[model samples]
Target: MTQWTAEQPIVSIRDVHKSYGQVEVLRGISMDIMKGEVICIIGPSGSGKSTLIRCINALNDIQAGSIQVEGQEVHDAKLDKLALRRKVGMVFQQYNLFPHKTALQNVMMAPIKVLRENPAEVEARARALLKKVRLEGKENHYPGELSGGQQQRVAIARSLAMRPDVMLFDEVTAALDPETVKEVLVTIKDLAADGMTCILVTHEMGFAREVADHIYFTDRGVIVEHGAPAEFFTNAQDPRTRAFLDQVL
Candidate 1:
């Protein structure tokens, strides 16, 4: 377990509400994510899990409330989006790699192009990140040539190349085949073991049990229950949470 001594949360969300026109997706959501903590969110489809994480990164807008990362309001109009993105990395369900670029180039793009980092230094770091994700030899291959698992690993390496303080994974293995799912999960587990602060919206209950320091169960846009894994998974008090666990577990 990580020794969490930070005086304030790395990410703080308070009284958040989101909607798509008439349909309210998130209703008064609130949570504090401490540095170096691994938080896993589990819930049924259409429960606003993806929307909530997207809000943290300011990829989606909220109707009310506030989200802050490292003491800066995420939705602030004057905020530097480039700097925010550099500090917070996000990986989606799809690999989303540029098919035209080699794995190495895909990992090197943002740092060199957006950040204007030195080409030589970016190349070195990109190669090192590829190795870190266990995709060392496939660096020269394009996304089309790699298997789904390999491409996803490359995507993870691309995210890591930014050296973000926090990582958000939104159902990263949802599109993968069963056999390939374990590979991506293993890579995420390695990151968590190294004390990376990660927030994941995942359906892999077993993975959530093993990797998560805290587990949150959301339903109908509200967090129904949350607690340390040992207590949340076994001694859940909310009826909705217990029912959901019965069906899934």
Candidate 2:
């Protein structure tokens, strides 16, 4: 088991409340994600798990409460949101690679344009990341040429290219075939093993049980239960958690 240290949390969400017009999606959601920790957010469909994760990275605007990432207030108008995005990498369920760009080009474009890094440096870093994800030979391949799992790996590689301090994964394996899910999960497992501070919103119960240091179970826009995986899964204090686990597990 990995020990939790006394280091300050890298991501802090304090009483966060978000709603889209009349529909309230998140209700006073507060959580602390420590540096080098992997947290899995699991819940039923339309339970606001994705909305909660998206709010942390400011992909969704919050009407109330605050979010702080790496000691910077996320909602601060003066703060560069784009720069903040680089620090908080997000991988979507869909592999959002550019159709016209090669795998290498898709990874390289962000650093070159957003960070204004040298093309040579960006390309080198992109290649190294692709290699890390075991796509060393597919750098020149287009997204269409790769399988679903391979494309997702490329998406993971693209997110890592920014050297993010925190990574957010939203149902990353929901779109993959059951056979292909393992490869993406393996990549994520490697990330967790490497101490990448991650917030994953997924339905893969087995994956969450194995990779998550901490797990939060959400329902109807609230975090119903949260604890170490062992406690959360085996000895849950909340009836809702137990019921949910029983149904899924």
Candidate 3:
């Protein structure tokens, strides 16, 4: 395995901060994500795991510090937000597919509209991506007709259609039924195996242990601990990390 700790960063966050009204969320956080690294972040609800990643893709603006992706500043005033988004795909807990569109249509829209790719080519790639996520024949199925897991898979295919450099998954399996969670997890595992850079914020400790190259523990708006799966899971040093692990693991 490559030593990600020594590698140049694909996403670099420096002393980041975020807040809502009078309440502060992220507080002076810093981390560098290396290319082809699968990073999983775990924490209690309201610990700012989602917020941090949101800032990474500029979904939420930071109050202080900077986030750089592939040498481009994410929050720069003149930054081409749409262009940045094309390089960083994000999946949320809810399967936010367009109700009126078929699975394939959902996956094909961005590449066609935003990237202005040939419609025929986009359709072909969409079909392949849907199949990659194990949705071989469901291309014609609408979101409402599919199960939550299948819908989530379509969401993944949609993100993959953009051909992003980094993928951020925020509690993707959280809303799925117990049995369906496995299918989504399997899809993500396959992506990891295919060498996609993934940053996942999940409550699925087992899945994180299996798929994540680095595990991060966040608490009260700060990264409290981080380590390789073996080190973080077995020999955590921070009290907050140990206590949280005690509850989850």
Write the residue-wise lDDT of candidate 2 on 48-85 in tens digits. 99998888787888988888887778877787888799
Check candidate 2 and list the clashing pairs: none
Model 2, residue 71: C-alpha shift (Å): 1.3
The list of candidate 2 runs beyond 4 A from truth reads: 1-6
Q: State the displacement of the C-alpha of residue 190, model 2, in Å, after optimal TM-score superposition.
A: 1.1
Clashes of 2: 0
Instruction: Go through the candidates in order and give the clash count of each.
Output: 0, 0, 0
51-74, model 1: which lDDT tens digit per residue? 999999999999999998888889
TM-scores, all candidates, are 0.96, 0.96, 0.96
Better of 2 and 3 by lDDT: 3
TM-score, candidate 1, is 0.96
lDDT for each candidate structure: 0.93, 0.89, 0.93
> For model 3, what is the alpha-carbon lDDT of residue 17?
89
